[model samples]
Target: MFVIGIDGGGTKTIAILVSSTGEIVAQATGGTSNPNSIGIDEAKNELLKLVHSLSIQNPKAYKNVVSVFAGLSGIESPKYKEEMKQILQNQLPEIAVTIDNDAVIALFSGTFGEPGVVQISGTGSVTYGLDSKGNRHRVGGWGYLIGDEGSGYAIGRAGLHAAFLEKDNRGPSTEISTLLLEYFQVKQIDSMIPLIYGERARTTIASLSKIVMLAADHRDQVALEIIKYQSQQLGEQITALIQISTFQLEGKIPVVLTGGVMNRSDLLLNDIVKTLKDHGINQVEVTVPKLPPVAGAVIAAFQAVNKNLDKISFQNRFLEDYV
Candidate 1:
């Protein structure tokens, strides 16, 4: 028998076919299946495309498929989950289907389906945790506008604000101003105004986070301050989730740090760990996932069928065949 696992997000969707023995047999990718980013119909179409591709890539494994677990972004509401479940059920009538937020798979990626917390800080940010009793909790992930305090968008926006402040002589001088000008390939600070307000505003602004990271690498005081503040905010979210969950009582809690921003910058990651310790969370066992989030979905597929594959063996097989 075999199972399928899917990780769907605003940017893209990835699906994999894994044998009961934990060998990855086939994989496929498709465009965004996030119902919030694209409409439900379009998202459904994208998911179907990915499944069809997987079947075509390896028909034998696809035929043996018994269950599917999809961890999708923007599937917060029950309405969206049901809609997604129906879509998968309609396509693979005989297979069991499970739908959940993308963060679930991210957490599972590091914990291997064990109870733990995962903090994601990419274009957007969110913190999710699961307790031993199966109770789940989430913090942040409100998107770029109102929340996402420690996200790439947040860092980028702050960098831009600092650049403008220095330009207007309202704040301390920093190299971010010159870097921002070069990044947009413009002569004056105001030249990038139209671009910033353009259609891809969120992504465009979020992209500036790399520039901030670069400045910090050169030991820019202003840029370092921004990272410190953002790391503190993210740390607060993690601590908040821990306090609200059963993890607070546990002697040691697993905390997985994933996503582009957290993974790319050792500086930021170190600061977050420091902030957690400062907040008295001394028992956190922080880990960076060796397996991708999609692997969590695959593990979920196995658990759905009550097949308990050995963790070390599964990781070895998955890494050899899929990673």
Candidate 2:
């Protein structure tokens, strides 16, 4: 039999067809299927297009498909999950369909579907944990306005705040002011106001995180402090999850760190690790996923049907073929 797995998020969607033996038969990518970003109809259309593309790539494999698992962002509520599942099932009448949050696939990507925690820190941030009993919990991911403390937007906004403080002589001088002026191609810091409040305000602010990372790498005190504080916030989320969940404090717990900001900045990763250690959580085995979250969706498909994939062999083949 064959299975279909999908990972859909705010930016893009990936779908893959896999054989029972763990061979990836066909794959396709398309625009975002996130219903929250795009309307539900558009999201459904995007997903159907990608799945149709996969079928066209390998009709024989698609014909044998038995199950489909879709891990999507912005479908946290049970109402949304049921709505998407019904839509997919209506289109593919004979197949079994499952829908869940994108965070589930992210955790599976790192833990091979075992119990673990996944912390995502991109333009926004969120922390999710699954205990051994199959109980799941989440913290943060409230978006830019209220939460997302350790996210790229937060770091960038902090950098911008520090620059303004320096300009007003209310804070110590830092390299971020010069960096922001140059980054925005403005002759003076105030000239960036209009550009920052433009249509892509959130992304624009998030992009400034790279400048903050650069400044921290150069040992700028303000940048380092910003990173330090953000790392602490992230660490607190992890620790809080552990304390609140069924996870044993002394047991070997896997922690998967993914997302653009977490992946790119070793300095920030190190700081987070230090924060965890300082909090006396030594049993956490932190790692970056070798495969993307879509792989986890595939794994979930296999699990849904009481099937299994050889973890090491699947990883080797997938990295060779897809990465």
Candidate 3:
């Protein structure tokens, strides 16, 4: 049997085909399919195109696929999820389709569907935890406009704010000022206004978080402070999840960290771990994901079929090689 897994985010969509034996046979990519960002119809179309492309090269594999697990952004509402599921089911009537928010699969990817916490800090930040009772709670992820306190967008915005402050001689001089100026290629600090306010503003700003991390690596005080503060915010959110979760509070609980921002920067990761420890969340066990989010979707597919992943040694080894 074959199963398909999809990880759909604001920026892009990825689909992977896995054999029942756990070998990845094919993968495909498409443009952003976040229902919130692109409309439900567009997102559905993107996914359909992706799946069709994957199947075009290997029709037999596609036909044999029994289940599809998709993790998507902008699926917070059950209405949206059901709508997406219906759209996908219509496209692949022979297959069982499961749809959930990106975080759900991310958590599953990290913990293999076990109860655990996953902290995502990419363009935006959000922390999700699953309790033993199947209850899930999410903290943050309000977007760049409101929350997303400890996200790449937040770090980038903080760096930009500090740069602006320095330009106006209102804040301490830091490497970020020059870094931002260089990154944006603006003759004057104010010149960044038009580009920032232009197209893909959120992504453009969030991309700058890398520069902030670079500055922090160089021991820039302002950059370090920004990372520290953001990490603290994320840690606090994790704490909130722990308090309300049904998971054992006293023993070790798996905490998984994912997303580009957190994955790219050890300084930020260290700061977050430190903050967690300082907050008395010392018993937590930070787990390195054994598989990517797409693989998590595959695991979900297995569960949908009432199959146990632990019984498959090849699947475990396949996931280990990739991670």
Candidate 4:
């Protein structure tokens, strides 16, 4: 039997086809699958297109794919997952389908199947934790308007707030505004205000994330604060999950950091590690060469169907090194 792993994100989707022995026969990427950002029809279409593209990449392996594991971001409710499961099932009735939050997959990839916590920084932010027994819990991911603390939106919004504060003499006048504008080649701040107020601005604001990186590079106090603050939020999320987990993950679970933010800057991840260490997390270790989250989604799907993550480590290493 073959396993399919998919990472469904806000902006794009990645699919990897793996043989039972852990060889990645094919991989494909496509447009975003976030239902909140892209309508369900568009999301489903993109998913179908990507999934089909995966099979098309290797016709021989496609016939052997017996199970599918997909983890999607922006799906907050069990109802949403069930609905998505139905959709995927309808598309391929013979294949078993499993769905989970995008962060869970990230955690799996980050830790290579060792139970742990994951912090994802993308258009949004969410922290989730899992234990040895496969129990899962989460924090954040409320979306851009309400929560999503430390996400791309949150970071970009902080950048703009710092700029405006500097402009108004109430906050630090930093190079972020100029840096952000330069990143987008915008002529005026007000221009962004209007664009950000509109639908397209969400995507536009995401592009502005470079401004945050630039600020951190230049040692801007606010930028540093933002990065550290976000790390703290993630740490707090991990701490909470660790505290509440029923499986007793206090000392052994690996702490995995993932997503765009974790990859973009080691600064934030270092800060998070330091903070956690300061709080007495000695078993802390980093998962190098991030495993694609879709692998975890695939693992989740497999586990959901068979109710076992025992081979999770083997599958993770297979795909992580498979690439």
Candidate 5:
């Protein structure tokens, strides 16, 4: 029988149709379905609707599907997962549905449920680890107010603050200053505060992260510095995950770079890799997850698939949707 996987995050919800043999037959994309952001009711409705739509598209094949695996961003607590599973089971009574936090699947996706580190950077940020012995630990992911450092919001806020600092002659001139002004089409830093705080101007501020990345790519010193800081922070997260891990490893554990910040910015990713090596953790084997996290969800759904974890490495060669 075939299987399905769903990855629900703050930015987007992704679903993948996987053959029992693990090849991707089809995929569908939808808007944000984070239960924390969009309430549980809305999130559930959106997820079920998307799944139903995809299932119907190829009913002859999908009707044979037997299980579904879902990894969501906000369902961290057991109570949350239980409530979500009940809602999902009610909607998909015939199919076995399992729910887990998004980070679990991300770790599973890379190490194939083995021991290693998976660092995720999306609307927010967190680092997760699972050792060979089934132990798990996590760091960061406290949210925007206290944590979520090196995230898009953090990057954008840094750029904006730097711009205004230069505008008032409080800090040295930075490329972020010029870039932010140009991005917002504002003349002065003084005008930016009110503009950003305005209702209409609220959503566009996060877009500044792209501009910040571009500034660093062009060798802007301040932007590069910001990226370096983020890289170090990310590296530190991995270090903490490894240090706190209870898994007994024969050697250095592998590390996987997942999420937007690691995948998007070479400055940060490379810096992280270098930091690992510098710390003498030479066993780092960084592999890009073959499937978007939705695919990871599908894999998680097969928790009872009775297969060895290490045998399926999620390498580029793996997407074989078996009929």
Candidate 6:
């Protein structure tokens, strides 16, 4: 039997087909399918498109698929998970489907199935961890309204606020205004108000972190301060996770960072590390994901079917292109 693993998020959906023995056969991609961002209907359509495309490309393995593990965004509530599971299962009947939050897959991929902490900072942010005793803990995944402090959206929002403050002479002048203008492709900062508040505002604002990064690279004091502040927020979340989980503080803890913001901003990464050390998380270790989140979904699928991840020899040449 074959297993299908999917990592669905705000930016895109990735599907991978792997054999029972962990050999990767094929992979496919589709547009964003996060139910919260695109609505349930659109999310279902995107899932269907993704699955159909994969099936079409690998017709020989389509009927052999036995199980599917999808780690998706907008699965914060059980209601969304149940609705999405029913929706996706309806598309491919007779196959068992399991759903979880995107952060879970990132954690699995980050730790390679071991116990560790994973921090995600894309359109939204969250820090989740699993301890050696199989205990799981989550912190700061509170969407844009209340939290998501260190997320790309937060950074972008701060960037916009800084630009406006500079424009009004309420704050020191910074190069972020020019960068924001270029990023939004607007003649003036006022032109962005409509777009930012128009539709999918969270995603639109989140994408503007690039401008903040550019400004910081050019030594924009305001931009650097924003990044530093966001880093501290992320560090606080991680620290909280460690305090809440059954993780050991004496030994080095592998802290994996995922998402666009974590990967793109060096200054933010440095500040986060610094903040962690300052908070008595001295033995904390940080690294990037060794495998993609979809691969992590595949690992979850292996566990779901009573299979051992370490027992699978996925090093065969057929799977050379993937981990």
Top candidate, metric lDDT: 1
- TM-score for each model: 0.93, 0.93, 0.91, 0.82, 0.87, 0.83
Sorting all predicted structures by TM-score, with the top scorer first, yields 1, 2, 3, 5, 6, 4
Compose the digit string of candidate 4's lDDT tens values, residues 1-323.
57788898877788888765556788888988888877777777877887788878898888877788888976776776777777778877887887777777888776645577777777777777777777887778787878777677777787888877777788866778788667656887666666577766665665566678878899887788877887776676666666673845656667676766666757677767676677776576655344567767666655555644446556655756554
Q: Which of 4 and 5 is the better model by TM-score?
A: 5
Q: List the residue pairs that clash in candidate 5.
A: 23-319, 23-320, 23-321
Off by over 4 Å in 1: 20-22, 245-249, 320-323
Quantify all predictions' global Cα lDDT against the true fold. Answer: 0.88, 0.87, 0.83, 0.72, 0.72, 0.82
Q: Where does the lowest 10-residue lDDT sum fall in candidate 2? A: 242-251
Give the worst 10-residue stretch by lDDT in candidate 1: 243-252
lDDT of 3 by residue, 1-323 (tens): 88888999878898887776677777788998888888888988999998888798678888888899999998877887888899889988977899988888888877776778899888998989877667778777788999898889999999999999998999999999788789878788899899898768998999999889889889999999998899888888888788763544335888888888767646766777887888778888886565778888888887888766763564576565442
* Candidate achieving the largest TM-score: 1
lDDT by residue (1-323, candidate 2, tens digit) is 88898999878999999875568889999988888888788888888888899989999988888899999998876776788898878867877899989999988989887888899888999999888777888889999999998999999999999999998889989999999998888988788899899779998999899999899889999999999899889888887787774654347889998877876658777877888898888888998898889988988888888887789888888777783
Give candidate 5 regions above 4 Å deviation.
198-205, 245-247, 307-323
Summarize candidate 1's per-residue lDDT along 196-221 as a digit string, tens digits.
99789999999899999899989999
- As a whole number from 0 to 100, the lDDT of residue 310 in candidate 3 is 64
RMSD of each: 1.9, 2.0, 2.6, 3.7, 3.3, 3.5
Residue pairs with colliding backbones in model 2 are none
Candidate 1, number of clashes:
0
**What digit string (tens of lDDT, one per residue) describes model 6 on residues 1-323?**
77788999878899888876667777888888887878888988887787888788787887788778899987777887888899769877887789988888888776655678899988889998877777778889888988998999999999999999988889888899988888778988788899799668988888888788888989999999999999999999999999883665347888989888876757788888888988888877787764678877877777777766553355242246563
lDDT of 5 at 122: 62
Best-to-worst order by lDDT is 1, 2, 3, 6, 4, 5
